[model samples]
Target: METEDMNTDRVRHVLTSLMILSFLIFGGLSAIILITDTPLTTSSVSLPFAFLFVSAMTLIVTGQIDERPKLTKKYLRQWILVCVFMVLVAALAFTLA
Candidate 1:
C-alpha cells in the first residue's frame, strides 16, 4: 500500500539521519577526548547518554514531520521506551565503570 511505503520511506530517512548524527556527535566527542588527554573510559561512560539524547531528539523531530499523527505518536512512544532502556543501561555502565 502507498501508506505503508510512505511510512517505510520516512522510517528509512529517520534512521539515516540518526546514523549520520550519531557519527558526527560521537566522532567529535572522541576527538575532543583525544585532544584533551581524557581517558577512554570517560568516553565509554558517556556514549550511552549521548546515544539516548541523540536518538530521542531525532525521533521527536521525525515525529513532527510525519503527517499521520497516530503513527507518529506510536513511534514516539516506542522510541521513549527504547530511550528509557538506554538510560538504565547507561546508569548500569556508569556504576560499573
Candidate 2:
C-alpha cells in the first residue's frame, strides 16, 4: 500500500511539474511574439524547440525533488499533448491580437 501511494505521489509531482513547465513555455513564446516583429512561421516553428528545452529543464529540476524517476511513455505522451495545446493557445493569442 505504501508503494502504491509513493507511485501516485511521484506521478502527481511529475504532472504538476509538466503543467508548470508548459505554462512557462507558453508565456515565453507569447512574450517573444508580442515583443518582436518576427514572422508567424518563425514564431510557430520555435515553439516546439522551446517546449523541448523547457521540458528537459523541468525534468532536471523536478528530478532533484525525489528519487530520479524514469520518464515512462505515459509521461512523454502527456508532455507532448501539453506542448501541442500550449502552442495552439499561443497561436490563437497571436492571431487574435
Candidate 3:
C-alpha cells in the first residue's frame, strides 16, 4: 500500500533515529565516565549534553513540529529550561572537574 515517497520518508526517519541513538549513546557514556574514577572535564560533559540536546531538538523539528502539532508551548518552555539547566550543570561539572 505504501508508495515510493512513503518509503523515502521512512528511510529518512530511520536515518535520523540512528543518528539520535548514537548521540544518546555518547551522552550516556560521558555520564558513566563522569561517575567513574577518571571523571569528566567541562568540555567532556558539555559536548555530550550539547549533542544530546541538539539531537533531540532536531528530531522534534524534523518529525513533529514542522509537520504536526505534537508539542505545546508549555512543553517548549520546559525544554528551554532543560537547555538552561544543562549550562548550569556544565558549569558545576567544570568546577568539579
Candidate 4:
C-alpha cells in the first residue's frame, strides 16, 4: 500500500511538472505573439493552445484520481494518454509548420 501511494505521488509529480512546462511554453509563446502582433490564423499559433488544453486535461485527471486510493493503474493510464496527446500535438504542430 505504501508503494502504491509512492507511485501515485510520483505520477502526480510528473504530471504537475508537465503542466508547469506547458504553462511556461504557452505563456512564452503568447507573449511573443502579442509583442509581434502575430495573427492567430497561422498554423503554428495553435501549438501553444494545444499544449494548454492538454495541461488542463491533465489537471482534471489528476484531481479526479487524487480522491481515489489504490488507483495506480488509473494513474498509469492517464500518464500514457497524456504522453500520447502531447506527442500527437507536437506531430501536428510540426506537420503544420
RMSD of each: 6.7, 8.8, 7.3, 2.4
How high is the lDDT of residue 47 in model 1?
A: 70
For all predicted structures, in order, the TM-scores are 0.54, 0.46, 0.42, 0.77
Candidate 4 lDDT over residue span 1-97, tens digit each: 7887887888788878988888888899889889988877646576777777777877876786788746757766876787677768776875777
Q: Residue 27 CA error for candidate 4 (Å)? A: 0.8
- Model 1 scores a TM of 0.54
After superposition, candidate 3 runs with Cα above 4 Å error: 1-4, 37-40, 64-97
Candidate 1: residue 37 lDDT (0-100) = 81
Candidate 4 TM-score to native: 0.77
Say which prediction, candidate 1 or candidate 4, comes out ahead on lDDT.
4
Per-residue lDDT of 19 in model 4: 83
TM value for model 2: 0.46
Give a tens-digit lDDT track for model 2, residues 22-96: 668767777786688566674464564556555664564445434534544445566567656766765665466
Q: What is the C-alpha local distance difference test score of each model?
A: 0.66, 0.61, 0.60, 0.76
lDDT of 1 by residue, 39-58 (tens): 66843646745664766566
Residues 1-97 of candidate 3: C-alpha lDDT, one tens digit per residue: 3574565466457647855784877678776776785555575666576667656754654554335333434444565586677757866776676
Q: What lDDT score is found at residue 43 in candidate 1?
A: 32
lDDT of 2: 0.61
Clashing pairs for model 2 are none
Query: Between which residue pairs do clashes occur in model 1?
Result: none
